[model samples]
Target: MTMKDPKSYDLLSYIVVFLGFYEGVLPFVAKSTDWEPFLSLPRHLSSPAWWIVSGLVIVASFFSLWGIDIAKKRRHPDA
Candidate 1:
């Protein structure tokens, strides 16, 4: 967790949090009821909306990772 190392997970977080939520919730939701954990874009969703949404999601993800890195640095300054 050193400042130099900036210990932070990347792809692992994405798979575990995002995809895991999708997998766990989607199945149970459908089985219990007709609920959906999430949904894809509308068939007619505009390209600008798609790009803006995607860009924001990507930027937010990067910020999350960056914050984790900063936290690790604070937690274990000499790591």
Candidate 2:
């Protein structure tokens, strides 16, 4: 029940990490007079705590693809 090594999963991992990093930083860089809370919420949600959760999510997402690859490999070991 191990995972398979698929290039697509790696690319997706990079994309998700990039998106999470963007979400984590955009709020801080945003400017406004009274839009404080909304902007800050994502920053908060993107905190170390949430980052840990999101990191797990990215790993799980990678595993999901890995699982698919594993199944495919089981079906066609030559591939």
Clashing residue pairs, backbone N/CA/C < 3 A, model 2? none
lDDT tens digits by residue: candidate 1, 37-74: 34533212364564455445555656665776566668
lDDT of 1: 0.48
Task: Evaluate residue 55 in candidate 1 and report its C-alpha lDDT on the 0 to 100 scale.
Answer: 48
User: What C-alpha lDDT values do all the predictions have?
Assistant: 0.48, 0.52
Q: Pick the candidate with the highest lDDT.
A: 2
TM-score of each: 0.44, 0.38
Q: How many clashes show up per model?
A: 0, 0
CA RMSD, predictions in order: 9.1, 7.9
Candidate 2, superposed: residue stretches over 4 Å from native: 1-46, 77-79
Stretch of 10 with least lDDT, candidate 2: 31-40
